[model samples]
Target: MSDPSRHPPTQAALGILFLILATAFFAVLDTSVKYVGAFVPVLMAVWFRYMFHAVVVTAVMLPLRGRSLLRTAHPRFQVLRGSLLLAVSAISFVALQYMPVGEFTAIVMITPLVVTLLAALFLRERVSALRWVLVTGGFAGALLVVQPGGNVIGWASLLPLVMVFTYAWFQILTSKMARTEDPMTMHFYTGWVGALLSSLVLPVVWKTIPDAGTFAILCLIGLMGTVGHFLLILAFKRTQASTLTPYLYGQIGFAMFCGWLVFGHVPGQLELIGIAMIVLCGATASWLTARDRRLPVEPPEA
Candidate 1:
């Protein structure tokens, strides 16, 4: 059989395609969360999201990888990682109730910038002047999206920012764990951990589906989250992350399109400018990270 990674050009192209498609699925996941959040309690929705994800991943991977799928060197870190992502999902569900899908997505895309900041502060990693500038510009862009006195102000606006920080830490931990852990094992543990943690509160938040349509949407949320991260893993396997990093910003565009299509929400001029800035700065930072060989090839939490 031909070696899949031998042809750089072909592998890169496939990686880009998979990354873009993964972003689309993430967009769908967010849009569905926003839609379903209105009818379902946020915690309940979160539980369903993680539960479905864990169940599906278990069903699919068990047969293929057997018990090896459950092995992990850092079991405690896996739980911590999963807990952080569960926090992210809960925060995202609440945030979406107040923020537009596109704008929320744009703000979350600042994660790479935040990661740079954290690495410098905690890891004592030296950062370049240009990267610092990009990081500053990226947050500035986020400020534009969640401008002061805007509709997304107050605690609601702060949610995604909180998510960025939480997710930044998650990314840092994942990068550390990826050095010694199987990606599939990490993926499996993350799902189950989130599911189990959220289930602790399920009894308080659980409610009837209200209708079949809502149940389907809940399932769609799980499928999108699972498939999106799975595709990200496939993309990284096929090609290097630096080559695929820039296209990750495509999630913002897909999200904006989904927002407009689903909610008829068009961003104002300033929001558009901010979104553009975030995309530019984030993509540039990722490129620089790749050039410096500092970018870790790991799938992000959905």
Candidate 2:
């Protein structure tokens, strides 16, 4: 007889669809950030994003989980993780001011590659030679996307690289925390931590919204970010990370579409090739990871 307590097999297709929707929401969030970046101070824009995120999560989650919503075994690590992610968002917004969204996201996608290296170094995970080769190719792809000799090369181009490294560490912390914390609890802390930290600096950088339209856009930024992250959590719950990791590359397509539709920018040939390399390498690395865990691996198209 089937054990009623055992969880059912993961719904891979549903997970992929959730991930795609998450990506679309993220793309819209970025578009909103880039749009508001023109009118608001970067710090203020970031503050509103997090402040509203905290408010929304609290309103929804606190009622459901009550005091348990604030429970965490490692509070310091949670704060640091949220702070690092805040930094990534702030830096990315600044970079978006000067770069196209698609290219910036392509660069940020290197976080997976960096995470592989960090896992080997810090987590002491066994990485095979083939995976190492894939990581190396991912770096090459990043270089192609950056193109030091090309016009796209500038200080702004470096911001996403910084964000990626910080994000890699953030992911490591998240991996650790996921072992002991409820996803909703973690999400709650992320929003509050970011909101609280940014509030500390708001006194020096506050900017008033000049109109209702801009205020509405600011709210949209928070709504999209909160919803996107929630969808991502839901996606992971439905499938193995390895099964879902490859579909993350789908973000590139969504980002590209949003960039062109909003800004009339299309990636150049070299940039497109670089994106392909990064996606392929990252997907392979994720597959190897799943295989190491003895989980069933699926193709990118699957």
Judged by whole-model lDDT over C-alpha atoms, candidate 2 comes out at: 0.78
Writing each residue's lDDT as its tens digit, candidate 1 over 52-87 gives 889988999999999899888888999999999999
How does each model score on TM-score? 0.95, 0.90
73 Cα displacement, candidate 2 (Å): 1.1
lDDT of each: 0.86, 0.78
lDDT tens digits, residue span 191-245, model 2: 9899999999999988788899999988888888888877787676677666677
The best candidate by TM-score is 1
Please list the residue runs of candidate 2 whose C-alpha ends up more than 4 Å from where it truly belongs after superposition. Answer: 1-11, 290-302
Error in Å for residue 18 of model 2: 1.5
Backbone-clash count (model 1): 0
